[model samples]
Structures are given as C-alpha cells and as structure tokens.
Target: MSFLRQRKTTSQIPLYTGLQIQTSSSAVPIQIVYGANKIAPNVIWTGGFSYTTEKTKAGKGGGSISGYDYRCGFALGLCEGPINAVGGVWSGQSITYLWNLGLGLFYGSMPQTPWGYLTASFPGQDLAYGGLAYVATASFDLGSSPSLPSLSFDVHGLLVGTGLINSWDANPALVIQDLLTNPQYGVGFPAASIDSTTLLGGSGGSSYQAYCTAAHLALSPVLANQEAASSILSRWLQLTNTAAVWSGGKLKFITYGDAPLTQSGVSFIPNVTPIYDLADDDFVISDDADPVEVVRSDPFTAKNWVTLETLDRNNWYDATPVQVWDQNAIELYGLHMDSSITAHEICEPSIGRISAQLLLQRSLYVRNTYQFKLGFEYCLLEPMDLVAISDVGLGMNKFPVRIVSIEEDGSGILSLTAEDFTGGAATAAAYPVQAGSNTALDHGVSPSPVNQVIIFEPPPDLTNGVAEVWIAISGGLAPIYKLADGTTGES
Candidate 1:
C-alpha cells in the first residue's frame, strides 16, 4: 500500500483487447510525428474476414465440441514515412507476443508488398500508400469477436534524409524544418522559407547543436489531431524560450536567450550596438506627455518555490514532479507555489528543475513592463531583439529591454511593448537538493560472488555414510546438480 509501489487503475488492467492506442477515426488526422509515440492506425484495408471452428473433446476423445474464431487481414495507416521501424507493439496493456497472428507482419512504406488477402481478392491491383508509414498483417485472430482489439505501438517515426536520419529527431530546430517542408499534411514550405540567420538554423552558428549544446533542449513531440499547428509550434517556442517571426519577408527563429542544461554561462549573450538604441529623440511624444508607460509588478506577484511538471523517460514517460525553491525570493517575498510550467516534452529531471528555477528567478526578478512608440526607422525591428531605452525626462539611463511585441498603424506609428531583461538575472541558479525516490523500494538484494569452492574426500569418522567426495562451496546456494556434465541425473 506504499506510494513507492506502482499504482494500477481498472483501465490499466490487462484485457483481451489490451491497452488502447491513440484513438483512430474514420477520418483521422495523420500525425507528423518525431521519436516514439503510442498510436493506433486507421484501418485502411480489411479483407479475408472468415470464421474458423474446430471440434475438441478430450485430447483423443474425438467428440464434437465447437470453438469459434474470427480472423482477417488488414493494412493500418500510421503516419508520414519512411520511418525507422515499428516496435513495442502491444495488445490489451501487454506487449504483443505470439498472438494468433499470421507470421511476418510487414512494417514499411511505399511500393509496399500487398497483402495476399488483397492480391487474392483484387487481382493485379496494388495501391501502396507511398510516403505514408503503415503496417500490414496477413491474418489476425479476434477470438469470437469480429472487430480488432485495442492495438497500440511505440512507433519510432524518424525522418530519413541528409544522412542524419534517426539522429536528429531529438532536435526540435532541425525537426521543425522537416515538419514545415513535408508536402503531405504539412505546410510544404521550401527550405528558402527560413532565413540563413534564423536561430533554428543556429542564429549563432550553422547548427542549433553548436548554439545550445544540451540534451534537454532537444524536443520529442508528436504533432497530431489534438492541437493546431500554431499551438503546437508555440509549445516548442515556450519550452526553449525562443521565438519565431517573419521579418525581411522570411521566417526567422529568434533565440534571444536559453537556459541550457549542460552549459554554464549567461542565459544569453547578444552582440551590443546594432541592438537598436532608442533615445528620447526617437520616442513619439504622446498627449503632450512622456512617451513611455511603465508598470511595475508588486512583490505579491512573485513566488519563492516553483514546481515543474514533465514526463520522466525512466518511469515510462509518466508525469513526474521537479520542485525548485528560490532562496532570494523567499527572503524578499515568502514561501512556495507552482503550476506555471507543464513541459511534457522535457524528459530529464535535472532539466525540469533548472527550468523551474529559471521561472522562479524570472517571476521574482522581472518586475517591469514598458510600452512606447517609435517611428518607421525601426520598422525592420522584430520581436525577441534586445533594445536599449533612454529617457532623460524620466531620469533613467540607458536601460536594456527585450522586445515582446511590435505593431504599426496607418499613421506608421510603430507601437512596441518591451520587458526588462537583464543578462545578470539569467545566471544559473542552485536550488536546494531535490527529494529522491523513497528508500523503501530499494529492497531487492543480489547474492554476492562465490568466495571459494573445495572438494575433498572425508575421513570415515567424519562421515556417517560412504561418500566418493565431499564438495564444499561458499557465497550462494543452488539446487544440487552435476554441472560438469550439464545434467541433473544426480539430484
């Protein structure tokens, strides 16, 4: 009854149908997936539905007793192809073993070998759903039921090209490109849609890997029916704290900052100067008043403790809690709270804790929001770019702020909203130690290695019965056996 033990609900109990896969509909949206995910295929092809019955009495009784079985062949459409492979196929909450399925179900794409059921049913007719990942089975048993069971799979949908193939699924920057360029069920954009300097193409270098060298920043997400494309893309932007916008008539990904897992340095490092410095002269005077409006959030808006929720790869990708406490915030504000972050794509606990701490720091430290108007001279200015604001009327020196939004009216008045972003506040945080798993679950004990083994004949006084030899062993016990011959004749 301890919480350390795995919890099972009624739905998790194994049944003839097995664990359920992602739902499939007659008109289901094919997912543009990366990495492994549980999914159910849309049954595109079905044929050779037959019922088989056999008589069984006793083993040799030869009496008439009826046992019924329903069987069929099917082709299941999964996702975009050519994926790496299909595995972890499951039925009814358990791994699929030697179910009453026919031998050698095929897992592949394009010019796929047609099922014999199809070939036999439709002579010389073959329509292989090219570029579409799917699975085909010749014969599947359904006990007495005619419909298929609750099938599922841990499908590994890898893009195969540019020599990177399976390796790049973890990198969201690289993976996003594939998702955009895919002609089927994707935006089908050309590679030119992305500017060479786009952060996804490594705003700092040619590869995001060269920019952010951390495993946690790499994302594993399945783009499916649940979310719109914009919403799905927002998840990546929020998780990485990066942004994507159109400037210069091209899509540009902007990584103004990052909290990398393995790296130790400033949250972000941007080249100064060309950062679009704005002086009072550049500000558009409004209502015969100051050109900027600043709103400072009170300390009540801050929290000292934050908990991040994410999936744990080691624990079957189930939800796990990663808590972080900001000591400085506690001293200034008060105690703990969370629910600000739900990064299901983050699979590493350390990264989750780091992100939670980053949120805490930002909440407690980032206190001001600025709004002002500039002329069209800054029309080329885009979001995610750090800018400098100076207003002598407000008695403020050159202050740095990151552009959060930009808008232009018919009057060509460019409206901008910026937030205080100090690189010093982005420094890595060291929260107190996180709680570890319960020690009560560490009950498994392994036997130690054998220390010695001796075999010698015993004296007649020491032995009650005659014996050829007395063999003594240490360290562990085993059922008595004749290991020299690999036989158990001498028990």
Candidate 2:
C-alpha cells in the first residue's frame, strides 16, 4: 500500500485531506497538511495522498508464480482538485487539525452530480457508546430534477415568494444562533429571523430610494394583502363577542385571521362565544395582558360611534378586554383585530406612526446613570454619543438598566446597538431594530433594547413624537425609566 503513496495514481481518484487515516495492510496511511497553497490561503492539505493494495492470484497453469501477488498504488494532488479548490478558514486559529468535515457542502453534504449532494457524518457523537462513527447522515437534491422535493421547499418557496424575504439580509449567517440573535441580520425587523433576505434582490441598501422603491415594488402587494387581512381583522374586531357568552372561565379563543395577534394585534383572540352574546362593538380591554376582570370599553365613545369613523378600517383595527391589576400589571381575556393588524398572526405590525403614552401610570422619566446636553442647556444626556436611551427591566435585576444604542450613519440607514448589562449574553433578547424615522412605536420590535445607540446609516428625513426606542427584555420585563428623584406611587 505504501508503494501507491510513492507512485501516485490517476487523477480520477477522490482523496480527502485535513485528516489522517491508517488502514490495516489493505490501505496506506495518509497525512493531511493545510496552509500549503499561497494563492489560496484557505486551501488546506496540499500534496496530500491516499493509497490502496490489491491481491492478485496466479492461474492454475502458473509455473514460476504459483502464489498470489500483491500490488500497491498511490495518487498525486492537483492544484485545482476539489480538496485544493474549496477554501475556508477558522479566523485566528492557525494549525487546525480537522478530525472530520463531512464533505464540504451546503446543508452538510458533498455535491453529487453537480445538482445533488451527499454527506456522511455522526451527529449524536459519543465516545462511550462508540460515537466516533458516522451516526446521522443527510443528503439533498439542490436543483429541480426529481420534480418534487419536499414540503419544506414549497413552504419555503411560498414564504420567499411573499415580500417577507425583505424582512432580513443576505449576509451569510454562520449558524442558527447567528440567524436568530444577530440584529444586523434582520435590520431589527420582527420575524426577520425566520424570514429570508435574498428575496430582497440581494441589495439591502440603506437608502430611502432603495427601501421605498423596494417597498413600492415588492412590499406593496404583500402589504396590500396585509391590508386586506388587516381590514378583515378590523371587521372582526368590530364584530361583538356575540359568538359566545362572556363568563368567568378559561376562555377559548380562535384566530379566524391568517395571522395571530402578535403579528398585528396583541394575542390571538380565540373564537370566544361570549356567554352572553351582546352586539359586539369596539370593546377595549383596560388590561392588555390579562383582560379578564378588567373592564372592557368601546374604542369609540357612543358619540363617535354614531359618526362611524372610517379609519384605515383595515390595518390598525384592534380591540381587547383588559383588567389592570396594578399600574404595571394587567389580565387580558378577549381580543379583537383592528385595521392595523397584519396578515401574519405572529408578526408584530410596524407601529410606524402611532402616538403613545404611559397608559397605566403617568410619571416623568428621569435617567439616573448619566446625563447629556444637546445645546444651550445642561445636557440631559451625559456622553453626547448617546442620542436616546430607555430604562427597561432586564429580569433578575432590580431596575431596568439602559440598553440599545442608536446612531446616524450619515447614509439614511438607522443602526441600533444593544448592550447586556445583566452579565448575560448580548443575545438574550431578540427584537427588531429596522425602525424608520416614525416616532410611533407600532412598527418597531417589541421587547427591544431599552437603552442602546440606534445609528441611522442615513439620517431619517421624518420625525414624530412616537418615533422612540423600544426594547422587550426576557421574562416579559419591559424596561421603564423615571426621574431619579421621582417617587413610586405603588410598587
């Protein structure tokens, strides 16, 4: 077998590098060395080789050769072979001894027949139970050859077909967590994680023209569909809980809308047949969380209801039954859709241009950590670098520490940065940051960074009182800020 190592074989043989394997007589040992190619810095294991031995038997009429003869062979490396062609690197790590790299390919497999791919690897690897072997293997057909692949493809295609792809960027994510946690990956847009960016024409440019044009061309139809659905939600919200009688019990809600409340409304309103069927009107639950026990009111006063205000009547329609237990807590029961709700049930609507107030309580927000000054007056913000900051509850901590960072990138794109003062991972919370210049908190991501720099690559050309920062921390700890000397009315 060693002979093959010395005298290489033909170019047709496939040899794996970056690994060393010793075969018992039947095959020769191989040594893989990386960093041999200068032109291709990522190229690993050049001049690597493999060998094999063959046993030959003598014919019955053999004279001099009565026994079997053995032969060994080897192969040489080509500068353009697959091994030396594919490039990759583990930044900062120099001598990387790769144990196994299951044929370098997408979705973990080697390309077979250019369109199809195959790969072998052990996923549930364990040494005690002989885990150092190929455990779970996966292969995929990339191209449309077999006609029908699977449901995942169709579902993915449908989602991509929708403008939902614009929800994220195409910057190749390194891992699932990167796709989930990285804010830049999704431009801080809600549902952008599960969404795709490639569908956005590959150029997620930070320009009013770019996004506006893209929105005009791409999101219009999607938004139209969304508007239609939102209209339906608004209509549904206008419909009373007459479907069922209202009673004190475990409410059963069903979302007839395509999307859930998280998308455009709050929570999905189960198809609740209020025990006492009353002609449904725009009922507002004082408590957004647990609407039960909380009083429900008409969104439009009887005076306004008579006029039948023709609002968007499609996208912003929302109503729910809420009971406030305290200034910070509430119990929500019944929910209704509004014209503002989107088609996607889980996708939070873009609170792009709505006004807001500390609904439950009214107190001034005074920052404690640092203060800053913009002009002519004692800077309210300490470091001028900080534009606006929010004090949010970061679960397990006493008070909500400042988080998200907002910055103007001079290019019209808004960039936001979040910090983890809780000593947890910076990714403990996931929310959108692709907030436009609208002061309204509607379209922005919920449970977002309370205090972080939001840099607009290009300064937004619009303004409103609601275009403020919002952060949703884990454990439902929504951060709130108050003046340092402000007294707590109630704990």
> How does each model score on lDDT?
0.63, 0.22
TM-score of each: 0.69, 0.16
Residue 13 of model 1 has an lDDT of: 17
| Highest lDDT model number | 1
lDDT of 1 by residue, 1-491 (tens): 78899877533212222312244466667766576555666776666667756555656656553555667766777777767766566677555532334424444566566555566776665565666777766667777666677766556675421112123235667667767776655676777867656544322342343333332355556666756667777777666545688877788776544333333221223343337778888999788767788988878667777777776644445578887776776777677575667777555565566556656667667778899999988888888777888887776677888888999999999999988887646434544434344223445865555757898999877887677688998775444666666866422
What is candidate 2's lDDT per residue for 159-189, written digit by digit as tens?
Answer: 2113222331111111121222434321232
By summed lDDT, the worst window of 10 consecutive residues in model 2 runs over 149-158
After aligning candidate 1 to the native by TM-score, how far in Å is the CA of 41 from where it should be? 2.5
Question: How far in Å is the alpha carbon of 439 misplaced in model 2?
Answer: 26
Task: Kindly state the number of residue pairs that clash in model 2.
Answer: 112
